[model samples]
Target: MITLTLQTIGGLMIAYAALRVHHRVYTEKSIDKKVVNEMRAEQIVGIAGALLLILGYLAAF
Candidate 1:
């Protein structure tokens, strides 16, 4: 039970962090090389977070 709870929390935190990164990019007014790179990185991180969340749920069940 503790492991399940911890995994869920960890997934949520990672997902949230990815969302924050995405939001930061959205709020920026201009696009540049650095921003484009950050966007690509954020997408990777977001996908990773989603995968983690899915795996955590599967493991918990």
Candidate 2:
């Protein structure tokens, strides 16, 4: 379970970084709402994953 959690966190972090670069800051006004929503969702997932990882690591002491 811990290994799975760590792997999920790593994947989420990579995906989040990609979304942040490609969708978060746009110079065009014609961006799709779906893209915006996905970006936000990805960010949340990434943050949650990171927090879970930290908490799990702390718990393993």
Best by TM-score: 2
lDDT for each residue of candidate 2 in 1-61, tens digit (9 for 90 to 100) = 6786677568767766765675545434367878767666776776777677667666766
**Superposed Cα deviation of residue 60, candidate 1 (Å):** 3.4
Score candidate 1 by lDDT. Answer: 0.76
Best candidate (score: lDDT):
1
Q: TM-scores for all candidates?
A: 0.53, 0.54
- Go through the candidates in order and give each one's C-alpha lDDT: 0.76, 0.66
Taking all chains together, the TM-score of candidate 1 against the true structure is 0.53
- Once superposed on the true structure, which residue ranges of model 2 sit more than 4 Å away at CA? 1-23, 26-30
Q: lDDT score, residue 17, model 1?
A: 84
